[model samples]
Target: MNKETVEVIDRELLTDRDYVSPGLEIIKPDKCFPNMIVEDTSASDWPYLRREIPHNWYVDQRNNYVGFLSRDEANIVYNTALKFRGKRALEIGCWYGWSACHIALAGVELDVIDPLLAKEDIYESVTNSLQCAGVMDLVNLVIGYSPQKVEELAQQLQRKWSFFFIDGSHDAPSPLNDAIICEQLAQTDALILFHDLNSPDVAQGLDYLKQKGWNTMIYQTMQIMGVAWRGNIEPVQHQPDPKVNWNLPEHLPNYSVSNLSADLVKEFLEIVTAIRPYTLLGEARLFSLYSLAKKVCIEDIPGNFVECGSYKGGAAALLAFVIKRYSLRPRLLYACDTFAGMPDPSEVDIYNGIPANLTGFGVGALKAPIAENIKSICKLLNVEDIVVPVKGLFAETLPQYKSEIGNIALLHADGDWYESTMDIFNTLYDSVVPNGLIQVDDYGYWDGCKKALHDFERLRGEQFNLHRIDYTAVWFKKGNFLPN
Candidate 1:
């Protein structure tokens, strides 16, 4: 019998149609085949084959020869396709559904196709994992490869996938068929990802795809394979082309100095400085904070610096300089700004009275292109490292600072209004490592900033000390406060 007919008959004989019995047990490999070779062609980096799959699953090959996925790789793929979640997704060669689980984690309803799942036990394991991951309800597991079955599934679901992943058979013929299925079923803007292009079986398929005019990039270093729609197509390119200018695909994580060299840091800082131009764009208070941060950055501060109100990133440019100078380990200067000016004044009272500056002060309108600016700075510094530019209001965007919050040695607040200052101070204060300095721009220049600082002092009492050094106001954490 053919593979499809044999799978169906085998499944039917094991149990009643309604009471689907488990499929045949697979003999798990003693060592994952993907990791046998460390060459560029090896699945050495197929995060799933290396880190994420558990030993229990590996030992019980009867659960299907499905592999696991690393948390890092899972997050990367989820983030990369974040904009398309909640829409339809298709995963071919789903193994035990690890990648499908991740897609569902991003809030997408996914169709996971696998012939191995025809085995009752393997199917049960996959379904159990999906339910455990809170995605069983969103996932529709398909057993056979009938194009008609796939079409019917798509029609019954009344949805089309915006994202498609081919992870099934790496054999040339299987991947080629899977790609054809994805092309036929995907919506116009659908982005397709193919795994194991480095595999011998899929090499020809990848080359065929390139000839077909698909835009492809090999994440060889990470050993994750992916492909996307060429140029721009329908439903896929629908949303305002996401902020590709910054190129911080969630798939890519931020880099710290510990992993970078001095030359790299200096080169990147120069690029940031070019775009943010501390001297050219920032206000007097920001200028001073920039100067001070640069000085301390040159010293032994063991962490990253933050600019909560980096309108155009002038202060960030200064921090970038310091990041390069020290070659500090594990610290990256994070420049946060609402590329589009500020949030509406209606949401916060800070901008209620001040006249709008070069850019509308209280509106969520962009004064300058944030991504382009940072890119320019990167180019000037000749640093390959990317400066993460988060776009959103302080309240909405600060939450992402969680990773570096506890290690922040310096914080420059340039919101210039009471609500803005209060938000950052209250929310991020506890996260500041001991002895860190909180610098406030416009503390003396604007009524709103001063009022907020006073309120903070009243609340904290002796917890911290506030000092005025020229145009800027600085807060030194008590007890741990040390001098440079």
Candidate 2:
């Protein structure tokens, strides 16, 4: 029972490299609880309580327990270990040894490296949990940080690992750094799993593995998990929960304002300066409108530009300016609105259990200035010829001018109320040509507006892959013209 001599021998056996003073502490469980039987009830408590248990396991009470891995995520770890049973495994960042216990239970020889294990409390908890699970003897706990510690293990072991579970630092270079080092030490056909792919920075590590010729796939666990391997091994497939909103996982093409030409930037600045006093739209939203206008013209989308709720004629003015400067052929800008104020919000315009009228919206709430003022602004911009102001309710004017409006290349639906917003889509959504853009200005600010868009989606039997323009505005193309 010589403690220091046993530590030196364990270090030498686990890692052949020279042990630096105050270096990694290798703890080998002595099988003190040899007769202990981890009851099935143990799975119904602490870190495993809230996790989804296997159907065969009986539980007395199901309570909530918060931990790193969800039930599905833990299954992934256990299944991966089973695939490589009897092989050497390495895990970085083992919090309370939940994932470590899962790995050990699969008959895999595991080495878990984590900096927090140096603390006495964390060490006791991890060992106690592992011992309770009847797998403490299968895991060699290493106390140190990753990348550097991983490098030392690589040098000392001088052997490739069959499986790697990297749940290390989620910061940018930290995850990426661990992936780089792990890939070097991994066998040619090894499987490498990474947790927390929901973090953009952590996802970069998985991205690197793909770049290096590993077959990669992502599982939509609570925090998201990704696996990369080089061989024919197919990891178990876990479908994402239908209840969770897995925000767009794949890349989509978007219009970047930074790519705008210097001349276009200057033109946009001039338009914003001219219309700043007439509209309530922020610079980001106005710029989006300006960009979309240019896009339709450049692509020859073959229709007019229309604004449904032209509050004070600012956004309409910007669209008119874009057409005047960029369009190769003649195209008109239709400013459709009441020109008096917003119409009365109906019962359907309820938001968060409150009527829209109670939340600063009612008849005459967003009234525009006198018609003469809109006309004066149009004249000042020299866009009066193309900017046609159709003053009336969208319900009335849109149908009245259906033949005149014809096919629309772009639609800016700014109507704040649910009814008014739906009116714009109901009357004109079909008129928008394929690949055209429909920008909703209040989709995020007004819940009613959001509901209207969702209702429209249900009516169309398809969802619009909306792209955010700002905090309150979003836009989508008329059809699926680009990959999501």
Candidate 3:
């Protein structure tokens, strides 16, 4: 852990145009910001929010503000800490004091800690938000880096921390450091809330706590943003169920999408409907593609984008849309697949009940290859140049381009057969860069795919915490990008 002062970013890293993480499909707010209670606004614009908070203040704190965290998350924080009244609470990064104010509103006297709070350029807005929220009395400003502040609080506080909110340096180690500190400072029954569930760092921190038997539960008001807690208050058994499906949106759009711009997704969906007609993909998995792609691009993770199974090219098309919309051109999106439908299955796949027709049907032989359609669709979408199609079985073609397809950021394996899935897994799993996302589209529904994932985990000797968005698709994050 970096025990020195928090190294605050000199300027904002994200912009309004930057699709907020976990954003896919956009929902019109029934009531706009400051009033939106339970609705999700993960990958969305902030005009409403801009109007709510003063523009100058928003500009100053926009970089650090968890603008995606709306009222539902605030309520959860307030309620979680409310029970631990009179307890010492910690807000690791008090950006604009939105979350810190909410932490204080929970009725606990919370310490608002942030390295930027020490800057004159930031202190006024941070304090004003708390003051306006009527939480200044309940809040104590601690201007220091997150990791070092934990040590300071550990020595100053009389009792253990009952409520801990970690929303600071998103680097993997920071959350882990905060978690370790919380373990030392927490009462027997404590509640810890972590932001940025999409972030590999926060996710890893939660995993560390879970291994130690913390009652950790992740909640996605819009997208996996708030990870809530229930400590030793109850004697529930430690259930090692790592994969939980984020709640399905109550209404399904005509075409489900990701956290790309609503306008961009709409146009892309129209083109996808024309080309794909039937996208077995769901909203959750689709959104994962957008969020994952955006993170790799935004964080500038060293890798190219690859999709092992681009059937009719719905997913590859969505990726193209995001790449074009975000102006991430020059970075190629390699869409590899057999022009023919499915390649023959191996014994393992056959034993797992994969039929020849679904697993090994040729394009011209009753089942036609859709590579041309994918190309045509991409052409119409003005993203054909970016979609480099390799028309052959994954086993046959992936090996030839092993050198060409260097590091990968998002690997979506949709080949349902065990032979096909594992072939891609063995071939490309190593190429996924740190903080990249590998999403399997058939794990939940296909026994062969599930077996392949299990066998791979066993071979690696490390169990990856798989997260499900639906019955058929599952995703797990890779290594943290935080520097050691």
How high is each candidate's TM-score? Answer: 0.42, 0.51, 0.45
Name the weakest run of 10 consecutive residues (lDDT summed) in model 1.
17-26
- Per-candidate clashes come to 21, 0, 7
Local accuracy by lDDT, each model: 0.52, 0.71, 0.60
Off by over 4 Å in 3: 1-278, 327-329, 346-372, 480-484
Total clashes for model 2: 0
lDDT of 2: 0.71
Ranking by lDDT: 2, 3, 1
Clashes of 1: 21
Task: Give residue 332's error in model 2 in angstroms.
Answer: 0.8
* Candidate 2 vs 3: which has more TM-score: 2
- RMSD of each candidate relative to the true structure: 20.6, 21.0, 17.9
Give the alpha carbon lDDT tens digit for every residue of 1-484 in model 1.
0111111121123212111101111111112222211122132333334232121212233322433433323333453344354567787766656566666655567787778889886687777766655557878898977445567777887657778777777655776666766677767666776665445455445555655666654432122455556423211111111111212223323211012233433443344335434333222233345445555555656556777776655556656655665644656666776676665442223322444342244456446576666555645664326356767677877876665445777787777667778877787766666666677766644566777777876787643444433223443442442222
Tens digits of per-residue lDDT for model 2 on 1-484? 1112111122224332111111112233323223222234344333213123221221112221224454456656765675565578999998766678767765578999999899886788778867766667778899999899988987887867889999987777899998999999988668899887766677788888888988887765545678888753445434444334444344211211112244665576677778877887765577678878889998889999899888789889889988998898899999988888888887777644767788666678878864655676788799989988888988889988878999999999999888888889999999999998989998766778988999988888878867655446778888863332
lDDT of 1 at 187: 75
User: What is the Cα root-mean-square deviation between model 3 and the actual structure?
Assistant: 17.9
